[model samples]
Target: MKDIRKYDLAIIGGGAAGLTTATHVKRCKDLSVIVISKDAHISYSECGIPFKLAGKVHDFDSLIVKTPDFFDKMGIDIELETEALSIDILNRKIELENCDILFDKLVIATGGKQRIPQPLQKYIGMDGIFTIQTLADGMKIESALLSAKTMVIIGAGAIGVETAAGIAKRGIDTTLINRGPAILSRLIDPDMAEIVSEFLKSIGVNLITGNIPDSIEGKERVENVLISGERIPADIVIISTGILPDVELAENAGISTGELGGIIVNEHLQAFVDGNFSTDIFAGGDCCEITDFITNKGTLVQLAPAARHMATIMANNICGKDTVLKPLLGPSIYVAGDLLIGSVGLTSKRARSEDIDVITGYATGVTKASYFPGSSDIHIKLIFSDDRLTGAQIIGKSGVKERIDSLAFMIKKKATIEEMLSIETCYAPPVSTVVDPLMYAIKDAFRKIKART
Candidate 1:
């Protein structure tokens, strides 16, 4: 029989969630903890890849928040390049290639995998074709950029748009292709997306909306991409369609998954098996399903901040603290050129899909007093349903993130337009207008609601 290593806690990933859980567990309890990761590198900022490529960040090494040495100092054991083959829930043992791990408690923080559409699957291993999900992936793309003159990025989600903006700013002829008519179709409404789309063009990204790549043509490496019978030259190709939860190991162990293909977990971050929650097994990060604050339905939030938050909650529960995760608003912010784009909760399209009757309010103003020096244009959109705030979108050179965060809180609290109108705000000629853009948006919503009444 092979020797099995036993631990107080075993985390199945080394990404943001897994490392965070390990650290938090050590902070609360003096337990034997180990993190298993298939990748060679760990604890790096996956979200900073585009910024690094764009030269906004100095180097990829700086993206690494913690090294194994740092974890060692914290008394956490890490097993790099170790993959979990399967899980035996009844035995609490994880089968690996050369060994097994027994644990008193197990955390499934498998994170997510980049989504490659079926049509593009054949080109995945081809030279000059890439996806940016890991530190290695980002490094590979960076190396390719050294010789590439033109680049084509497929999908216009946040990653795609950010990558296009970054690459274009580097003097590379970059093209962004989106199947939807508007970029960031899921994040913001079309009108707000137009503001970003126009800015992308102004910064030299060749925008191609409402089209899909027919094929990637190359002899041994990428030469060009075909879309609607037009061939666009490309020295390299990046697929940024999206990410999907990595729940294979969990599914193989008989864990239940939600419709979104993520492991189903309770409010306490406990994993489920055949509809019953497991006390010894917990899951978090991009691999687990969480509730949408507005809709109260299962949703996948793949952002790093959400993953860290979930890890903290899971750690508390593991330490015998009765803490529960609050439903998430799925707030997100992105940079494009000089603008900060942000959105929280649902868009009008998503609301209608959920059978929600939504009314919207729009306001355009300056980040500061109109006459204030260095003031920049700001656009706001507020979405309300049944007199309560449900969502918001903002695009501006400044104040976008703070405003979006405030709206996320309002949506989570189910604040009504009336409540929003009565809230107090601060004003500085250098920082904000006397009447914040958010107030004007709320007032607009109130007027619309009154008209209906």
Candidate 2:
């Protein structure tokens, strides 16, 4: 039996990875589990931060999945208000802000930190400025929003779009600014991003694209926003730019970090550098690198699902199950008001950057039959190489993510366009057409390939 004094396991961070790690081990009903969470709330969804700020969650309490009391009932010790400041791998000791704990196994799911970017850093904590990375950040913004009027959001990722929608829905003057030519350019093509931008502008969102912010014109608190010599009046400026991995503690401990500033972990999610190894010391979540299943290269993908998947492997390995860690295909979905956006695999630009020859086919269609009452426009663009599905970009109001996920799976498995031609899907008059649009897009991509040949 593992000594009780030296706990069976230690899980840092209370996000999806850390929480699931403890819960999965708890099912074994043998080992003593201790979870050290720096945050006050446990199992709160970090992705739901923007929703919380928008009052979609109603209250801060509504965001938590479970409290310390809930953990008590499950026989898991949750150490809240406790910060794991540093890790002493050789000594197997975790130095907390106030105390020290020795552990038999350690899992560092410490998660990422909110960065406001180099150009946007000065305006941080300027009353109107905020980031939607953590629950604490969400709560802080929600409290500050009581006085904010005109809000300008920087960046055009999921967080930016979501926050823009929230502010627009709240009757505030909302403008979403992007440094690139289009929104979510990193994820999809400019044309696909145009679909989203159009929808945002149609729904009362001030869309600002292809411009860099000259300065955040604020005295002490945010008062005015400037971008490309244009001064827009603003009471708040939420810089939903992006996130940087929280590698400070890990770096200080001399753990290997990735090229994208995330900690470098192996297939087992073990952090290594300079022949140094920490037994049972694993890192996952946004704080770690994403091993692209296709290229076998470490990419920066901060998705909760990937983190949870990593946690599962880390848990089983800790339990002596010896599970293999699977790389991810980088599937993602977004909801901007009525529009549900989704995509998977590589974008066309990314594929070309890798020096892969590609053919693209696009189709603009409806989600349902023409007779349907509540149908929205469904646009699909597929990337094909050698008649195989290489990548895709999709934008629609409904059933967008489902098709993207399916297409992404096919791409990872190297499914041919002919394979997509044979796929049978559920169809209805009100919700779907007789022929799925994916089939049509694949058929179109095939025709283009034939013509080129």
For each predicted model, how many residue pairs clash, with residues at least 3 apart or on different chains?
0, 0
Off by over 4 Å in 2: 1-5, 273-278
lDDT by residue (1-453, candidate 2, tens digit) is 322235778888888888888888787547788899877678877767777666677787777777778778878888887888888877777887667778888888888777667877777767677777667777777777787777888888888998888778878888888888889877788888888899999889999888878988767777788776789988777777777888888788778886889888877777775565455788888888868866678887788888778888888878778686777887888878777778776787888788778888888888899988988889898888787877777888888877887887888788987777889989888989888787777788888888888
Tell me each candidate's RMSD, in Å, in order.
1.1, 2.7
For residues 207-277, could you state the per-residue lDDT of candidate 1 as single tens digits?
99998999999998899899999999999899999999999999999999999999999999999986699
The per-model lDDT (C-alpha) reads: 0.93, 0.80
Worst 10 residues of 2 by lDDT: 1-10
Task: Report how far residue 325 has shifted in candidate 1, in Å.
Answer: 1.3
TM-score winner: 1
Candidates in order, TM-scores: namely 0.98, 0.94
Candidate 2 — which pairs collide?
A: none
